[model samples]
Target: MGNIQVALMTVLMFFLLVSLHEWGHYYFARRAGILVREFAIGFGPKLFSIKRGETRYTLRLLPIGGFVRMAGEDPEVVEVQPGQTLAVRVKDNAVTRIYLDRLDERSGVMRGEVKALDLERDLFIQLDVDGEIERYAVHPQALIIARGRDTQIAPIDRQFGHKPVGKRALAIFAGPVMNFLLAFVLFGLALLLQGVPSETSSKVFISGVVPDSIAEQAGVEKDDLVKSINGVVIGGNYEKFVEIINSSAGKQISLVVERKGEDVALKMTPDATTGKIGIYPAGEYRKPSAGETLTYAATSMKDWTGRIFEGFRKLIFGEFKLDDLGGPVKTTQVTVEIAKQGLAQLTSWAAVLSLYLGIFNLLPIPALDGSRLLFLGIEAVRGRPIDPNRESMVHLVGFAMLMLLMIVVTYNDIIGLVRN
Candidate 1:
């Protein structure tokens, strides 16, 4: 059941994220007057489709990646149907005669000899379209590919690119914006739903300290209330407590504690591995407030973005191991683990994950929305568009790289699961 819950949540997250991502493209494309041929989620064979306006929205079998197929998005794959000058109609049943010059718009001009029509599956098999044709499968929502004149050139209008640079940037940035917003809301709601445990030492004081930790070495013991660190008095900021621990980074620090109505000092080095004293204080209960929620949300954004950039830099510098990365399998595993803890815990995890996703997508990698924005920036500066072919090639390469990374991460996820 745990595994099943993980799988279910994984699917839910994938669908929601994919839908939002594609909607960002679809919204901007339409606003920019770019003609979209298809907006699809997932990849591989199509599982379902729905036609709206000129677009064929599809759901594919694989849930890894998605696409927004726009006119002029790919210049290499456009098919040119050869011109036909003949009358094509129902003869006895089959296409029979070739009229090189006769043209029929409704019924395509006949280019070959017409033969007798045969009845199969309760319909006339007239060897052509425009006749009574029976579609094999009934998919009420199957979207037809919009027809475009082959001879007529379809260009991506500059009106999209003509918008004020700021507006263009906003349109380009909305995807990440939405993601960040989701994260912020989730963070706030989590606090409202499940309050953060207060950091204040209880009146009863410390319960236990791990052996060989900073507290043990410092001569700190049970029934001690940590009054202050370094000269700063500890207050309501749970986040700040963590920050001080991390910032100290294994440095020896002075800790003032109140024990049995007497003040005592303890000096110890912070743990290198965990950066904590290993003293467990009695948990304090507090109610969430508007100010606290806002502060938490803002801090979450700052902390998460910092982590993302740090990871990115480490990855680029070869200091970070790819095996430390994860894919959907790991995400679902983590999400399910948090869910088992309770709704508030799950919500907080979701918020943090959303922020991470937002930051990751904004990295100026090719094949990402950020890359498109980069192209637009170059175009704005150069006073001309980048060579479409070259741009396409770069994106293709980037896409291949991203896929390779995903596969590697997924492999790592599986390996970690097995080891555990």
Candidate 2:
């Protein structure tokens, strides 16, 4: 493919990943009865917007990330002001429409007059954008914060905060959990198609040799097919082949080979470091036993999560640079490289990527699921919701730090691309 096509495909993949992640949060929030104001799939200016019911679904120009706006970040201070409160019919196309209520500010008793609606009766609110009734709840709070906060503005209804600790943790963890689930399913399918490794034989064909290494000195060349080592045929049971080579480590081994339809004999000592005569192996697909398949899957997940935590700890302790972090450009380069290897390889890497995303987002960094969970944890410990202004300020700081890291990573990606 051309450079432009490759770039576009990479960008699309990025958007897809971010969109699915954001959708996870949006879905859980709605399911948990939290009001989602805007659901956007990209960053920066909105390219197009479609208003459906109470939410304005938007598509933005920059397809890097997404956000879901919900209520209960600040205490609601409802007061009588000229343009502060508005009473609209239930049919209005606004995310948070509020009915005015008489407030003493000190008494804390909010009273509002609804033309024909009962004040003391339970009201059913249908939360559907397509005009089809899906779910409904009683109207609990009257005043809603479109934006900004004041002493007159009261805390909004229970949001990511009001839920039980376990429920809050589940809602916060849903995004990363979804990512892991995606990885597991994708990997499971790939395993079913490619089969699990039944043996452990290294590729007999030499792909390349380490320069100036023993293999190069011993006359091993790329594409050379090994007929045997020390008169032992290396085929059939792959594990036995590996065992033979491993047993010959640090000892001179006779290699019988065929190159360009010509028979050749080469003698080489296996490197004690990696235990091989420097040959790359072709991938052999083999059917796996039920236990073997489960073992492979479990091991894959463990290795994936292991790398994630390793990276996380390193980043925290200043062992890694922020520029090592990657953005769309780097991700695209990787995606295309994996794609060149064919669909099976691509699917395998996709599973790995999913696991990575799941773990990364679970980190307690600002503007992420983990950070939100951290705030919820604080609320749980303090026995009251955190101050909205303080919480907002903390997240703002995190968002800025995240953006700065992104800029550094993007610059690194561009530099690396130029060098390549």
Candidate 2 total steric clashes: 12
Compose the digit string of candidate 1's lDDT tens values, residues 128-186: 33443322221211222213321112332423443455555665677777678888988
Report the Cα RMSD per candidate. Answer: 11.4, 9.9
1-420 in candidate 2: lDDT tens per residue?
Answer: 455655565565566566677778778877776665678988889999876655568999866678776555433334334323233223233212343433333242223332232212343333322333232332443334333321111123335556566766675677787788777766776677666544565545554455567777988776676677789887544455567777887888887777998979988888776677655544345776677666767778888888878887898899987667778688877898765434555667777887888777877888778888888888788888678688888888998898887888888999989988
Displacement of the residue 275 alpha carbon in candidate 2, Å: 12
List candidate 2 stretches off by more than 4 Å: 1-16, 73-80, 83-166, 198-280, 287-291, 322-325
**Model 2, residue 106: C-alpha shift (Å):** 37
**lDDT to native, each model:** 0.65, 0.64
Q: Using TM-score as the measure, which candidate wins? A: 2
> Model 1 shows how many backbone clashes?
13
